[model samples]
Target: MRVGDIDISYDDQGDGLPVVLVHGHPFDRSMWAPQVARLAPRHRVITADLRGFGETTVVPGKTPLGVFADDLFGLLDRLGVERAVWCGLSMGGQIVMEAHRARPERVRGLILADTFPEAETPAGRAARHAAAERVLREGMGPYADEVLDKMISPTNVRALPDVAAHVLRMMRGTSPEGAAAAWRGRAERPDYLDSLSRATVPALVVVGEEDKFTPVDVARRMHATIPGSTLAVIPGAAHLPNLERPAEFTDAVERFLATVA
Candidate 1:
């Protein structure tokens, strides 16, 4: 259905408590395939492609975290869901946090994976803008080729060829305009640490042991900040742990859901 000017693309499956899965940048709803398969049996799984990615309408300008959050809630509203557990990875995680901030009453729980709440630094902001421009100019093929190893560890990339290929495919398939818009929006995202620290809802923080982008240290800091959050570290994965170490990642979510859902 259309949410504002964009037509959001989503898959809703199974029955039970609602669980919305948000995919990270340069990716789409397909990234949540493993989680949706496992969780749908026990919970309602809703996964959507953010604007400019996958099948969603591509708007060529800035798409802030708040706009992403609003789009998600608009989908939920149409589905008749009042509240649900919000789960996200990387940039998606930040969008989830933004959702909670925007409508705390609508978020039942939070599952933040391989992400941080810190605001972008001066250098980081500049780098993101530059990267956005580069993506616009050079396109996603080169960007996908460049970040494949960083998205998944080199060892895993070799050991799990299918997983590596899927990651690359998602990145390569993403719209350059959408990716660039997300980058610009992400650069101006506010620090979520304060809101997360004050959050009363249950949270689970998961990180891949081999993830260089958002390392275990960053996950630990996020865990410490959240009053009663659980921390799970997947041993043999990197940024995209759900695909690299599917069993471990799903197990963590299953365990966390038992308590909250």
Candidate 2:
């Protein structure tokens, strides 16, 4: 669906109540392919390429994260979906939080995967900006392999080279400007811990056991703050557990949705 100067591409499949799955940075709707395939059979699944990622075009100077959330709301409006259960990964998690803040009435539940409430710390923000700068200056190819190496578990890196290559290719496909804008906008996002604590929506937080980027500690903190939120750590996976352990990740999501429903 094309919405407000942007072509928002999305996949809507299956039946039952709507469940939206949003992907992280440098990835698009394809990142949720495995999840969609698994969950679409049991639930209505909606996945989209957040603007400037995948087949979506980049709007230079735009705050990608904010626009990304707006795009989701716009898509939901177009689909006649009044409310939905949102499951987002990494940058997608940030977008979901913003969306929930914007339209709490439309969010039935929240699932924040492999992300945090705030990245306001000097060191953390600087590291994010530096990574963005590196991507812009060096281009994505040179660092693509290294990034995938770190994001995926060592076993997956060794055994699933093709999968790793696909993720690297997606990273290379992202525009430098878009990536940088998203990084900067997300880095400056306000702390949502307080909001999470007071939220009425049922929330779940999931992360990989070996996730270095967001880490288990961050997930724990988020879980501790969000009242009654459940946190699950996927073993033998890193940042992109959805890709590395699709079945396990899907099962966890199913369990969470069932409990919340």
* Index of the highest-lDDT prediction: 1
| TM-score of each candidate structure, all chains considered together | 0.99, 0.94
* Model 1: per-residue Cα lDDT over 1-261, one tens digit each: 898878999999999999999999999999989898899999999999998899999988788999999999999999999999999999999999999888889999999999979998999999989989999999999989988999999998899999889999999999999999999999998999989998889899999999999999999999999999999999989999999999899999999999996
Inter-residue clash pairs, candidate 1: none
Candidate 2 clash figure, as a count: 0
- List model 2 lDDT by residue over 103-185, tens digit each: 78989999999987874798878987887788789877776767787778778888888778778878888888777777777
At residue 104, give the lDDT of candidate 2: 86
Model 2: residues with Cα > 4 Å off, grouped in runs: 62-64
- Candidate 1 off by > 4 Å: none
Number of the top TM-score candidate? 1
Candidates in order have lDDT scores of 0.93, 0.84
